[model samples]
Target: MKPQLLFSLLLASSLPAADAPVQIGSRRELFADSFLIESFSGTHLQLQTPRDEGVAFKFDQPWEGLFSGYATLVTLGDGRLRAYYRGKAVANKDGSEEELTCVAESADGRTWTKPELGIYEVIGTRKNNVVLMKAHTATHNFSPFRDQRPGVPEGERFKAFGGTMEGGGLTAWKSPDGLRWEKLAPEPVITKAMVPYKYMFDSQNVPFWSAAEGKYVAYYRVFEGGIRRIVRSESSDFRTWSAPVLMEYRHPSMQAPIEHLYTNQTHPYFRAPHLYVSIAARFMPGRRVLTDEQAAAIKVNPNYFKDTSDAIFMTTRPVEGTAHSGVYDRTFLEGFIRGGIGAQNWVSRTNYPALNVVPTGPHEMSVFVNQDYAQPTAHMRRYSLRTDGFASLHCSYAGGHAITKPVVFAGRELSLNFSTSAAGGVKVGFEDVDGKPVPGFGLEDCVMQIGNELDRKVAWKSGTDVSKLAGKPLRLRISMKDADVFSFQFMP
Candidate 1:
């Protein structure tokens, strides 16, 4: 043997062993990050932005206007949508009596109307649609979600976290249904005394029951070294929480940049529970674009135009056994959603996204962003994308391929959510851990996959049933030409 060959063998023997096969049962894996992939030859994973679909719901009601923002949408148990948002017309101090939490009802998300809840008399009569008011600072940025934790009491089926740093810390609330709510505790649950951060809870602090972590997770705002960042805490029950720790940032290939993340809208994707997607607002302080004359022309508040903001997308996956790594993956450095084509679109605290991205159709998902901020026309607009379409493994017309790390999955068929041009297609092949192709599952046996589908099974010459490979280690090699693959799963 050549001396170079002998030296290469010695180097390989000193290296660490490869990672164990990932155990993904039936979970739908998305290309939002590079976790599942090992190598790429000609293809690269490209992050996708949601399509702007105009206004989904307008906050033009008498109780909601100008300053109305921090919207959170929840799909109730009965399939109807219950949207909650802060109702304030005047710019006032935190927890002002004028600040109210209002709800809008929608059978289908296309049309929304305020239901007469008759719960409180905030601005005069009790005939208004206010769900919470006159409760101190709790209603200032009250964010509630339907608790889906198994064995959770019916009375506490709904839970919320809302309070300013001055109001105490993070207060808790519970509701049997979604409308009527009462304080879970008279005092704030996570107080400033419990954490080192002095400035926090001023923005919308989100707390929810995470089925993925099997615990309650809270993603709240904090200012460290003059820059706004996020900290995380977890709880077995909704009452007691672990110590808050700052989350770490990671990238597949590049260094993650630090920016002012105003509100970290971190929540599990409805379809993929294990993956948490954060549609955070990137606050660019002092990054003014609108001149005083242009701001006045659009009727935007003079003070608000001094700075501008837009929404960004991120993802976080729980580290196994460790519970929380607090590491968020910054797959794409570019902005997920950009400022619109107008002067009014540039303003402080504008373009902040709501909490959850819910399904509007069988193959479609919608995310809402607060737009036209600090102006009379301020309203929540909707953006839609194909289900599990946050990012995709894309290939140009020249064609390319990507190989996944060794994985052991459970199911009978490999279902793919992909799109391709009429002349372009994708092919799949299975390889053993040693890099040899499996006889019947090689790329040569695959039928070309074309067209768009939310879930199309990968078919080989032997058909789509992959149950025989269940629980065994195998790698997937996907080759595509002018195609995009959003997500994939092993379905029963």
Candidate 2:
């Protein structure tokens, strides 16, 4: 269906209260405002926005030659950000040589300065003055780490570990400041643990240190049976590592012959410890629009020959001591999934729930629900909630899920409101962390009081005593009778 027509149809079905403001609670409408269904063919990388305004860092410098491989960002001790990137360029006068493992630094994340530290001694290179790493290395795709020890006498010293087929397995390097470097060990750190002969090997080191888990995680991408998969290992001293555990994130779109699956830094936004991965895919080309089916079929395969334009972003937030994991951020895959292009049934079969920490209210927050209706036309629906007596129906459709961005309501008491299609007869109520209804609240029998016909805005207030939930963390669950909901938001 046409975008405008589909939107109009959905809006027309909304609760028609001329003066009431529309409330958003479902995942569909929560993201409806600024959501852009990205395809695989886009040039932007994942997690590039939200964290740092939507500006993509330019790794390619005309003076530095083209083909600058993937980059890993790390924060230094003094709070400076350092980027370790793979440098691929012609090396010799005969055009028979290549350079690798080039390092650069930036005080702020935007502008980069490549210094001539003389790590590598080249015979005849006088164009842009490219001084490569002395130690012969090819691909440099790892996060940099600072080796700070009590007796070590720190003065801007760091180390980086990554994989290289040129040396058989993974390798490690040391740097006094991050500019100059030397190989720590002669051999690879962890190599060919349980794999057959020597199928494929690549590693992407994560930068964040997990104090809760007490172990640092390193995510690696491996190719087996022509399928791409992600595996993780833990390290305490960055020297020895645990055996690789297969990650739940596996899709045909993320496979790569040269680079491995890499993730962003860990932060509080994850609720728990999380990792963001940069995936490579070939989504639809240009800004041209397409039907939902046409958009869904768009495939994103890894193209090694092409520049860094095909990379996409995905996330993995571990369920914290659970075997099953969840994909926290997947807006990037929406277009491909909806378009019915590559891996049509992949996400559904693979999509698992993460350990989500629901926001409690001495304050208020939003909850979003996602419903997929096959009949009529494929679309999604939404709902909104607030702490005050404020509530309303947001939007509805056939084939999308709901997600809520965590919001904080200011007051001690909060109100929740909801609405649903009369045909669906929505059930509205709250549940505790264990998926059970709150005490004294009858969820099964509580019929949501319908407010209007066109917009379907219904509201109910539950005064949650936040005296106990003040500083502690908790989750809120909202249920509807049979109607699919997008989300509910909590306001002060």
Candidate 3:
């Protein structure tokens, strides 16, 4: 059997039966299927091909001189979808230079356009060209890095976390508009604590903003030769970060070089409260020598061996509601390699049985994956849920309270009916899973306001008012002095 097939089998054998009942609250029901093994058809997901396609702004020439390295997708303030990619232009046939930090944008996720003003530029000759972005005021040195995960917002700007070359230290950047970015002082937010270890760096830094804790949580890969591990950190105000905590999971063998990984945002899947996705890449030993023509095209280091293993592998996990503090109930998918030369030899032979855990409540989640390659490919997937048996509520509280039963929704629209028992004194609003009220993103904050009146039902639904929730996972909160929620349901 193919490695991919065997991997699936192993995963399947380890999982509970599909019909098994999962407990949520005092009720028991089959866990909703978060991932659809087959191609999904809807506004949320498109281009379900098996090929390894990188994220980029839609362009007229879809495949022309596109930078396909580690990439991140962000929805800008102007309602434009932007892709910040490790831009490397295709070199000329004569082995000339062409590579830089690139940026692209799309009104819709499907169509993309490269902006004239690229984010960062690399200068010098083809062989000696170096990255020309501002140095981290913290480190005061130039570094090679990629895979940037940007946070929602703080004040009027956004925060991003990524890794640097050599020591692989964690770095931070701030952007007012997601396009024009500025480096922050006191770089390397998190690093090895004065340890004797030689190799210490952060790979695939993904941040989750928590309004409940009023802090930021980051997950990344910690590399130790022959061993790739997952680590996490917490920060407040994006300045100082907590030390790294090693996760229990690791690859079976260290034969392959693991690069990076990511976690998918929490969203409703099937009918579950929260679904999380993650992807990672492991580069097996033995490299492929490229020809002069191919070498000139990509303009990569001639000495570096080409990646010969699978371009991507991913797994999914269901947050067991509020009962569990961390990840539980996991599932693995041995992704099929499509497109790119390195994908030819990739195979999955392990069997991953389905893993199921009882539902606890809605929890913060993220998705990470490696996207560095000769052709530099990346993968993204979308999931949806039905909003039945879910309700949205608005509340006013100085402390955090866990909604034992999170409101579930179908597609991405959240509709709720609420009322306040007081006069026109205070305004009621809704917040996301992080607790921050999203303005314009409707799901962030209350797009519609409710007047204070005892037993009054106010009907509200999210659409263009809160565009961010258009196709993303979300939660609701009410910040009114005397607000009470009566009913809530999501629409397809």
TM-scores for candidates 1 onward, in order: 0.95, 0.49, 0.47
| True-structure Cα RMSD, model 3 | 16.2
* lDDT comparing candidate 1 with the true structure: 0.87
Q: State each model's CA lDDT, in order.
A: 0.87, 0.36, 0.36
Rank list by lDDT: 1, 2, 3
Best by lDDT: 1
Candidate 3 TM-score, true structure as reference: 0.47
In model 2, the number of clashes is: 56
**Candidate 3 ranges with C-alpha deviation above 4 Å:** 1-68, 88-100, 118-132, 136-156, 165-168, 194-198, 210-214, 250-274, 287-306, 311-330, 336-372, 375-492
**356 in model 2: Cα distance from truth in Å?**
22
Please identify model 1 stretches exceeding 4 Å from their true place: 1-18
The true-versus-predicted C-alpha distance at residue 319 of model 3, in Å, is 7.0
lDDT of 3 by residue, 12-68 (tens): 566545433232221112112223211111111111123222432221222223222
- In terms of lDDT, the poorest run of 10 residues in model 3 is 349-358
TM-score of 1: 0.95
Ranking by TM-score: 1, 2, 3
Better of 2 and 3 by TM-score: 2
Model 1: weakest 10-residue lDDT segment is 2-11
